[model samples]
Target: MQPIILENVIKNYLLDKIQVPALKGIDLKIDAGEFTVIAGPSGSGKTTILNLIGCVDTASAGKVVVGGKETGTLSEKQLTDLRLHTIGFIFQSFNLIPVLNVIDNVEFPLLLQNTLSPKERRERVLKFVDRVGLTQYAHHRPSELSGGQRQRVAIARALVTRPQIVLADEPTANLDSVTGQNIIDLMKEINQTEKTTFLFSTHDHSIMNQARRVIRLHDGKIQANA
Candidate 1:
């Protein structure tokens, strides 16, 4: 079954008095465990699509479905729960808590759900920290880590929940070319190994080349899906 599906999905934002349509109408289906990239120039709605898929925003019209659940109808609390349970997000800026150490930063999402005990969370956090080669820096805070290391922590955090899907919005934007490539490779390996569906929103051709399938957006609509 497809992990994600969108049928004429439309997302619009109210900027002051104007209605800025970020996604005009989109129809897309991403199969389970697929590595997909949504590519487009800035202001072309790529990030908007990612936000919708990640359940950060609701579609204005049509359907946005994830894990066989219809998205447009979910309540805010339900959507939040869905995001927590089914999806993981990697942001471009690497949004780690300033005060938390690396291990705690990675375990923070699980804490939100209050579903796992401290021992379980530690086990989960260590597993991913090792996966991302950050086990040695477990006690270091975000301030003590380099950009690449911080991004690793971000990736570990994204996967700590064992989410079925991961949505990355310009995840490599702040990294150097070499480090960005490393992050991309790490994501690819993890997706294949863990059977997690991966999707990225980026204009970087380097990233597009690495992705198996690419969807291009333009002016709030998908221009090409291939």
Candidate 2:
């Protein structure tokens, strides 16, 4: 089954009592396990589309189905549940809690689910932290890590839940070119090995070149899908 689908999706934001359209009739489908990139310049609606698929925002019109469930029909609680269990997100900023150590930061999401005992949670968190090559830094705080290491922690945190789909918005923007490329490489390795679907937005040409599929947006519409 497709991990994400958007049919004739439209989105608008209100500014000074004026409706500003962001996405204009977008139609998209992201197959399970595909490494896809939504590429566009600023103000081209890349983040807007990701937000809709991630259930962070609602579409103004049309349908958005994630993991075979139509998001518009879900209640607030159901949406929260779906987000917690089915989707993972990586933001441009690391967004890690300053006080939390690497292991705690990666384990924070699991703590919310309350399904696993402390031991099970620790095992899962350690597995991902090791996968992201942060096993040695498990006890380090975010402030103690370099930019690449911090992003690795974020990646580990995102995947610890074992979600079917991961949505990232400019995840490499804050890192240096070498560090950013390394982050992308790590994500690609995880994508290949775990068969987890990844849909991330970025304007970086170097990053876009790594995607198996590239969907380019412009002026709130799709300009290319290759």
> Largest TM-score belongs to which candidate?
2
Clashing pairs in 2: none
Instruction: At residue 140, give the lDDT of candidate 1.
Output: 99
For residues 82-176, write the lDDT of model 2, one tens digit per residue: 89999989989989999999999999999998899999999999999999999999999999999899999999988999999999999999999
Model 1 stretches with alpha carbons more than 4 Å out:
none
List lDDT for all candidates, in order. 0.91, 0.95
- Evaluated at residue 120, the lDDT of candidate 1 is 87
Which regions of candidate 2 are displaced past 4 Å? none
For residues 170-198, write the lDDT of model 1, one tens digit per residue. 99999999999999999999999998999
CA RMSD of all predictions: 1.2, 0.8
Top candidate when judged by lDDT against the true structure = 2
Worst lDDT window (10 residues) for model 2?
Answer: 75-84
